[model samples]
Structures are given as C-alpha cells and as structure tokens.
Target: MASTAITTLSGGLVSVQASLQSRSKTLGLNLSCSKSVSAIRGLKVASNVQIDSSFLGKASNSSLWASVVSKPEEKQVFSSQLQPQASFKVAVLGAAGGIGQPLGLLIKMSPLVSALHLYDIANVKGVAADLSHCNTPSQVLDFTGPSELANCLKGADVVVIPAGVPRKPGMTRDDLFNINAGIVKTLVEAVADNCPDAFIHIISNPVNSTIPIAAELLKQKGVYNPKKLFGVTTLDVVRANTFIAQKKELKLIDVDVPVIGGHAGITILPLLSKTRPMVTFSNEEVKELTVRIQNAGTEVVEAKAGAGSATLSMAYAAARFVESSLRALDGDRDVYECSFVQSELTELPFFASRVKLGQKGIEAFVSADLEGLSEYESKALEALKPELKASIEKGVAFVHKTAATAAST
Candidate 1:
C-alpha cells in the first residue's frame, strides 16, 4: 500500500518535472527508453515525491545564475575581438541662412557624422528638427543667435563657418571680405576658445584672406594647429569640373579637374593637363572653360539679379568638405581633398592643394600636381601670388588691430 501511494505521487512528480524541462529548457527526452523504465521503477519504491515551491525557486535561480555568470565573460571576449567604427561631431555656423539648410540636409545624410550642430542668427530650430527626423545616426542640435555660438562649438570635431554677407552682381570677394572677415574672425575666436582642438573649415569669403585671419587669431590664442585649419576652396574645383565637362561635351560625372591656388579669379588654376581619362582640349576650348570656371560665381550672381550668389553650390561644396573632414576623423587613411592651408608649397603663406587626411588631420600635402604647369597656368599662378600675398597680409593685420583694440579697451 505504501509503495502504491509512492507510485501515484512519484508518477505525478515525474510528469511535472518532464513538462517543466521540455517547456522551459527545451530539453528533449525519450519517455519510451530503458532509462525511463528505470526512473519509473526507482520512483515507485521511493518514500515521498511532493511538489514543493522551494524546488521551483531553486530551478529558476539556477537558470538565471548560469546566464549571469557565463554571458558576461563571453560578451567581453567577443567585444575584445571586434573593432570600433569611426564617428564625428560637425558644427555649421550660419546654418539657417540660404546655404545652411541644404548643407545641413546633405550632412544629415552622411554616415560618417555622429552629431551635427547648426548655428545661426535665426531660423535654426526648424532646420534642426527637420534634419533630426532623417534616418541617419547624426543627432541634430540647433543654436540661434550670437549668444549660443560658443555652445554650438563646444566639443565640435569640425567647425564650418559659412557665415557673413554674400556677393552682389558687381562685388568682388574683396568687397564681400570686409564684412565677412569680421564675421569669420569673431566666430573663429569663439572656436579657438571653445574647441581649440577641432578642425576649423573656413567657408567664409574671401577665403584667401579669411583663412590667414583665422590662422593669426588662433596663433594669438596659442592653440593653433595648422593641419586642423582649412579654407574650403572646393567650389572652385567643382566649378572647374562642371565647366570643363560642359565645354568639352564630356560626361560631367567622370571628369575630375584639379583647381589650385587662391579662390578668386586669375588666382584659381585648373590643372587641365592632369585631367582624368586623358581628354584633349582645343586652345579655344581651354580658354572658354577657364573663363567660365573663373567667372562661374559671377555668372550665378548676375543670374540671380543681385539678390544672392552661389548659395546652393557653395552649400554643396561646403558639405563635401565637411564629409571629407568627418571621414578623416573616423580614422580613414588616404582621404585626399583640395583645401587652402598654411602651406610651404609656394611662396604664399596659404596655398590650396590636395592633402591626405587622417586622425592628426592633413597627414601630408600632395604636391604631385604642382610639379608642372602649362605656360598659361604658370603665368596666371605667378600673377595671383602678389594679390594673394596682399590678401593674407591684410587678414593678419586685421586680427592684430582687432586684438590690440580689445586690449586697449
């Protein structure tokens, strides 16, 4: 009778245990096996087989305990074997203006950026909110008014300044420079204070003078990194590629033209000799392409009928440069882009040329294109140095005078 009572309780317990094992642990069992027969017989002769709450508690604890102890070590080993992907934080000053909106959109699409900060005197909140909805990983933050400028630059990996006045139909970059220079200087001063280590990509014109102004201001702050400072002259190159392709009746997508020297007319030198795919151009074609490329901004300004100049293309070019800088920050090697920088390739303190970018920024200046120049290009290049030299000196003087004035007051 005792054995019969044991059999009934033991059979119930065995069923319960098997159900729990199959449901919770996914363990397969053969109920028809010889071991099952042995377990049934062994249980029938046992004294008691009561189902207890404590037993359930113990099983739960064992499963959780096993996972907690083993998973962490496994995860650590797995993570140690993996590599980290690149990331970057980019800030665009003047981001609510005409150029800023489209530029912000393009940057919002870049996989390289982890954060994008937009700053302007007005209308930046909408830009930020709109860009934030995009499916990219970059977090968008907007700063409006001059009071938030420093906050916008805080911890930035790259600061692109496209702030200041745009040119009218007859205005030279020098004419636009007077107003834009002040804007660039003030913003760069904030940059030098807030994120001294960030790469400063100056898109404010006149780039020739404004870049020198930034260099001098950072120097005064005693935190200047030449490799981290760049004057984004990418629009010149973009115009060169487009104009040459348009004139030569070639496809624009595949043509790559290198434009060196300063950003202004006569200063911009398109190295047509080194054009990709080795296309030949008639002298008439060369002159037409060069003039068109040099005067592209003027053509846009005139086409706009004096309201604005080159905002869309300028924004695109600036975004391209920001991407290049971000890619460099992400630890990309051999990332080459043309930028005007404090260079020794020419007599001018700042020269635009191709530079390889890395973590240190501007890993090396690629002077291969500068090795030879056509007679037309060489003479144009020589003429530009004097004008570019004056522009550089003027910027240095502006920073010095501004600093001295601030000191005296």
Candidate 2:
C-alpha cells in the first residue's frame, strides 16, 4: 500500500508532537512510538527539543504539523500516515515579486516541500515572515540581496527564478530582453555556484533568451545538466486550455493542450491537433485559437494597464509546473509536463514538448510526429525559428560578452 497521511482525527484533534534532531545533529534523544504508530521511522529527539502544545489550536485548519524544533533540515517522517508529506527543499528567487508571492503560497500549501527559501533583492524578508505564519509543514527562510543569494540556493532541490521585469503594453518580449537577460544571467550564476544540480525552472521574461542564458552559464560553470533546466511555458499551455475549453464549450478541467517551442510570441506553439479527449476544430477555428494562445500574454499586459502584468494567473501556471517538478523529485515516474529544454526535436537546440519527469528529471522528450503535423502547425513552426533563433543567440552572446568583460577587468 502507498504511504498515506493521517487525515481523520475527529472532534478536537491532538498533534502527536515529538522533538527531532537539529540541523547539526549533535544532540540525541529518543521517543518511542505507540503500537499503532509502528510504521514511524527512526523516532529520535534532541534534549533541547520541546513540543509546543499550541499545535493543538490548529486542529480545525488543514495544515501539516511540523516539529518546531531545529532549523529546517531534511525531513524525518514521524509515521507512515504522513507518507506523502514533501521533504524536499525548494528555493524561489524573486520570492517578493508579484508572481513569487502567490507562488510561494501555493508551494507552502503543498505537503511535499519540507523547506522553502525565498530570495530577492528587496522586500523578501517580509514575504518570508508573512509566509512563515501559515501552518504548513514547510519551514520558510528569506535571503535578501546578492550577498545572501548563495545561502538561499545552498541545498535547494529545485530553484525557481521569476526574477525580472514584467512585460508592458505595446512591448514585445524582446523589448524586455536586455534587462531580464542580465537578471537571469546574474541569478543563474549564483545557482551555478551553489546548487549546480538543482532542477532549474526559469520564468524570467523573454524565456527564449533567459533559458539559453541559464543553459550557457551552467555550461560555463561545468555543471550543465540538460535534464534539469526548464523554461516554464506552463502559462501558454494554461491559456490554450482555457481558450480551447471556452471555444468548444467544454468543461475547463477536461481540456488539455500541449504547448511547445520557445516561450515567446510566435514561438509559443499549442499542439491543438493533439489535445486530449480528441477535440475537433475547423481550419478557421484552429487559426484563430492558435493566434489567441500565442498572444495571451499581451492580452493580460494590456488589460492590467500599467500597474502590473499577469501576476496571479502566471503564479497559478508557474505553481502548477513547480508542483509537477516536486512530484517528479519524489519518484513519481508518471509525472509529465510540457516545458522548454535542451532538445533535438528540431534543428534548434531547444524545444518545448511533453517530457516524462522522474528522479533524474527529464527521462524523455515525448513530442508528437512533426511529419504528420497539420498544415498550419508546420507553417507556424517554420516561421517561429527566426525570432527564436535571434533570442537564443542574444542570450549566448550576453554570457560570452559578460565573461569577456570580467576577463578584461
């Protein structure tokens, strides 16, 4: 039987609290499990560890109970009931930003994250302080500015970067390239120095450029793991699903669209031909839907005016991808999602398609046959490469230029 969490404590529930070892593991204490809790693994507590009876107050609220003892270290399962509780460390760069704030909340709600590290240039400490109050199993920590960046990424299993400016009205993704490019470069460099093998999810704008920038930086550090780097195009897929559901008048959850290629204007390709439940569309409908999916980001930018971009929806989409990644880390071999990564699906070095996720990250890139593509998809795929190629080159050039500048200085 799969490990299961204890969810059915009726009336006033009592938290079975026990002290656990600290981060240093210097102190040793023991606690015996009840006969009913025979599946409890290695029940040890330090002498300094103490149970806070306050946890009993939260019986009505649905939050995982964590030992308040010790700085957040590796997870220790107190019993088999907490089986699916997440024990991995996830660090989010730009955790104080628009998308990061909500994204942090979603991850906090997960039973999978044991520790959550929030890092940003500013405003992050407060965000961490705010999120810490939520009674989740995951412990939250904040690191502000570049000085603390390495500390934030130190032991992360997954590092998510949403650290960049948002798109403005009338601005193409390339328009934000120069600014976001430098940001991604700097952040990925820190990631390289610290958690080189962490599953990297790049959500910076101009992802076509930033993802390549990340790939190259990791290569420069000699720690490039192709299976680990990902450009989150989940928003494109999310939009495709929503729009397709509306167009076909079907239930939203029933819709599934695989968005591929680089994550930008023309490059965002929704494989409408491969939508699940086998939906049908006319040529005209397909054309219109395709265009809408491609331009969905702009729609949000325009709608938000100048205040901000699609923070909430982008947060939702990003959270979806992060959850899938955490699941993959937890040894769920069946977890698969569409993302941009180093690939050979086309002449380009990177492409987005459905990829099977597991302990080793991307186990396989599963793209549908392009030879059997519909006429529109083939044309769209051909036309997208030029802009995408330019973006990729720009990213590669930025890294080389930065390295040269450093060498010169």
Candidate 1 clashing pairs?
none
Model 1 alpha-carbon drift over 4 Å, by segment? 1-84, 169-175
Q: What TM-score should be assigned to candidate 1? A: 0.77
In candidate 1 the C-alpha lDDT for residue 198 amounts to 96
Q: What TM-score, computed on C-alpha atoms, does each candidate reach?
A: 0.77, 0.80
lDDT of 1 at 168: 64
Question: Which structure among the candidates has the greatest lDDT?
Answer: 2
lDDT of each residue in 161-192, candidate 2, tens digit only? 99998866567756788889889989999999
Q: After superposing candidate 2, which stretches have Cα over 4 Å from the reference?
A: 1-86, 169-175, 369-371
Report the error of model 2 at residue 184, Å: 1.0
RMSD of each: 19.9, 10.1
